[model samples]
Target: MPESATYALDTRGERMDALEQYFREAARELREPGLALDADPDAVHRFLHLPAVRLQQHMLTPARYARHDDVLPSFVPAEASCAEWILAAEWLAYGDPGMTLASPGPALSTVVLRALADEAQQDWFFGRTSDWPTWAFFALTEPEKGSAATELTARLDADPSGEGWVLSGEKMYIGNGAHARVGVVFCRRATGPWGIEAVMVDTGDPGFHAETLPIIGLRGARISRLRFDGMRIPPERVLGRHRPRSRRGLQGALQAMLWFRPSVAAFALGVGRAACDYVLEQRPALAGAGRAEVDGMIDRLNRLRRLLRDVAAEIDAGSPNTFRVSGVKMRAARLAEDATLLAARLLGPASLVEHPWLDKAYRDVRAFEFMEGTGNIHRRGVFQGLLRDDYFTSRDRDVRPGRVAEGVV
Candidate 1:
């Protein structure tokens, strides 16, 4: 049998074991604060001193770029693998998805910075973040276009004053936008795909405005709408300016999104696991239909967890399978919804009122569908991959060549 087929949820080695232990403890500590954050997103700032939040602040920084003063906890690796990071994200999210998103750190912006920013730009970003618990945003999804790069209406044009560039447009559903001191905004410099470019923006700049949106789920994320009205961006702030135009804008965004898709899937899995754990814990002695339903949910959750771990390992191995990632993300999102719904049903109609944490989990899971990409979006990608016969290729390191493993997806 392929290793992926027999893969278990436990860590593979001592290093990952330690990481899992650290994050599990961190998640436990975050539960109360997470509930607090869900009630009031601003409460996140009060918990920045926590070790988990501090570790997350620098989790993605390369060792060479990381400052000695900003060193993560001794238990954390100087350079953690993608699998480790994904594992940490899942565990932290299991504690409280809202607080996990709300915690101050680079968040999604790290991916874009790594993919597109110059050395100096990276240094500046890391330095600022190291100075304090900084929040950064990746502004790509627009109000109307909804992250469709070709249809992006945001424009970046050369300034008439000739000192820099001017950015103008609106971006909606931007995580941490309302609180981020620094971020990268995607905009078009001219017609066609190559014209698209990403520019660094400081929130303090004139004409840069952000407002937290009223959202029903993941309240701690503080998803916001931003408007850039002739926001001046220095010429040097353009990301990947030294690279080919084709690789600078949408390509960089795509690379970041591809890298992040697995993490997003992991978030959903964490929520599903939380729901399952909640059900099992509260009703320790489930009978007949109740026990069967909980068992079925657990089975599905374990399969998805294996698939996610496999995908994360592939990413760490420098082989990202887009089709598998999309499929896992699609299925994981559904699993989160189903698991939470099952918990509610099994616990009965008054469960939401009686169990606040589970209720919060139910709401937070809804946002995972829209984060990174929507279910509809991923379904289309999976469908396309199937048509191209791209879905069956073995990207798993342990899988034999030309042999598709069962239940790995």
Candidate 2:
């Protein structure tokens, strides 16, 4: 019998090949000398605007976002949502990791809005942006509170007239914040069952200030620090106050992370795959353990990809195993980091100085370590799941630690 694919895609091989070529072309365009680094931000925006928006529409259309609510339509197969995201991330990584803003920002916004917004709010925002590419950001990370953002310091004080509110606080490391058209800014309400509330803030608002913060990797992302200095927003601007089945505050963020972590790993795998391909293509003469390292990395990367697909399958089946997802997240992050390091060791100093793509890949891989959740955090989650006897409980097939089967999810 032929091998079973992890994703259960009807045409996995053909789809991947076609998708790879599509993104490879985009990556080639962006990787052109002086284009990615020196092009005007607006120019880069123009280049990516259409492709980005179309990609988002494809991912969210046909009732796919319902998967986030733990509901999958019968028309969509169990692995369909996961397949969409994995392919999306793979393509984004192929284009340039920085281009990730095209997806994650809009994706998080959609999740937040669906979870917290009323029908009118959704229609107003989603409808308006349906035509042109619009970016939305989830601003939860503050300067002081890195990953532990449960205790919000940002405050949302109600207007004395009982009509609107004033937001006063700062958020840091907001991906695509500087460039986002809309932002879901999370803050603590000053009154009435006070808790973290998400407020929609238009970037053009005078009090909504955003400045791009450059990073070593994913430079094109336009990550920013946002200062909401008494920004006034109408009452309806707030995401609805109704409590979701899941706890609010960190719970919302956690839920987003769970849904997104596997996809995040897919991007990391893309980075690693890019690096590995460079090594194979260059055929660079290597020193001790360099060739062996590259060989080992190939096998490891394949295993990680299969594992990620499996996690996605479980999630699609309406049994999101957080432990499995965390394991995949932790492993994929380490693999990306390790694969890049191995490639660097194989290629020597020349890879960093002479190969811009490889260098970018190296820098991009680092962000995966921190994106969605950190390695330590994911490891902790996996351990906690293990303690609760929930680890791998829903996996379609048994997978022992360090002994994953090929082509298995």
Candidate 3:
């Protein structure tokens, strides 16, 4: 049988094949530099000139704003779809999750911008990035509130000067926060959900302050803490002004999360694939239980990849199944942890000391749990979906009328 036949999910066609191959080649350059990046987060600057890094910097830019000479693969659509993003994310992350996160680009901010920002706000953002390689952040999580929108205390009050708005609060664990030239900050203007709002802020402002945190894994991401001390925001800078009050902040944040959850799952799958691949490559002749274990992991990884691709396609088709996306993320994260742990166990005690790449993979995979949302959070989402009968239908005659099969939910 052909290699593709081994995995039923390999049905994405020739275009996706070329895209995957491109990222696979790009992943090679990241392996060596990824170690250096782990040791010194700032080392990412040295590798920014790599083709993959440059591609990431502009991958999400709308075609009109994209440079005519941009060398993106012909498979990329005028407006890249979520499926496209997830496919690229998985393969590139398979190369190096840390480096993939480290490469400068709009990152999560692009999702929020597209969901909330008006035409002018987007122009200001894409224009700056088009001028040069730029990094942007999406600031929503807070030190105490932990991104619980209802509980967040960050305030965007009317300027005493009666001219604009004054942003005052702090955000924590924001990726690229320290180095970002521009970003979107979520804050509250009143008391309820509708009070929440997202605003565009330039880090160059005097009131904006950020510092990189010392994190154990995914160091190259440069996750940082940010404080806004009376940050000034012009009226036009407030996002979602043209939309209804109810759909401004929290809705946009949720929409962005929904769209990106598949990509997050893909990232986890990539790390897991890397770990499993390393183990098998190192022990090519392994047999018995160990070989069976690795083969089982490969099978599950293939299934998870298929699920991720389906979720991405669903999102792109405008029929996102929120619970399914969350479930995929939860399962993928667990598989990554399991895969890395299995790699370590099978490779023996000295494996980490001998193989730096496997060691990094172990550490890097842990951060995916905290990326979009924690496993507990996703579990709650899946549970909610179960309660609503979102996963099954009455048409499934095999399923009981009111009760799901054991372990089915």
Backbone clash pairs in model 2 (N, Cα, C under 3 Å; residues 3+ apart or in different chains), count: 1
Q: What is the model-wide C-alpha lDDT for candidate 3?
A: 0.82
- Candidate 3, residue 166: Cα displacement in angstroms equals 0.4
lDDT by residue (27-64, candidate 1, tens digit) is 88788898899889999988886766765666776666
Cα error of candidate 1 at position 278, Å: 0.7
Judge candidate 1 against the unseen true structure and give its global Cα lDDT, from 0 to 1. Answer: 0.82
Question: What does candidate 2's lDDT look like per residue over 87-129, in tens digits?
Answer: 6676567556665544423556666665567777776566544
Between candidates 1 and 2, the one scoring higher on TM-score is 1
Measured against the true structure, the TM-scores of the candidates, in listed sequence, are: 0.92, 0.81, 0.92
lDDT of 2 at 242: 58
lDDT of 3 by residue, 186-254 (tens): 999999989999999989988999999999899989999999999999999999999999989988888
For model 3, the superposed segments whose C-alpha errors exceed 4 Å read 1-12, 68-71, 392-409
What are the Cα lDDT values of the candidates? 0.82, 0.67, 0.82
Rank all candidate structures by their TM-score, best first, as comma-separated numbers: 3, 1, 2
Better of 2 and 3 by TM-score: 3
Q: What is the lDDT of residue 248 in candidate 2?
A: 52
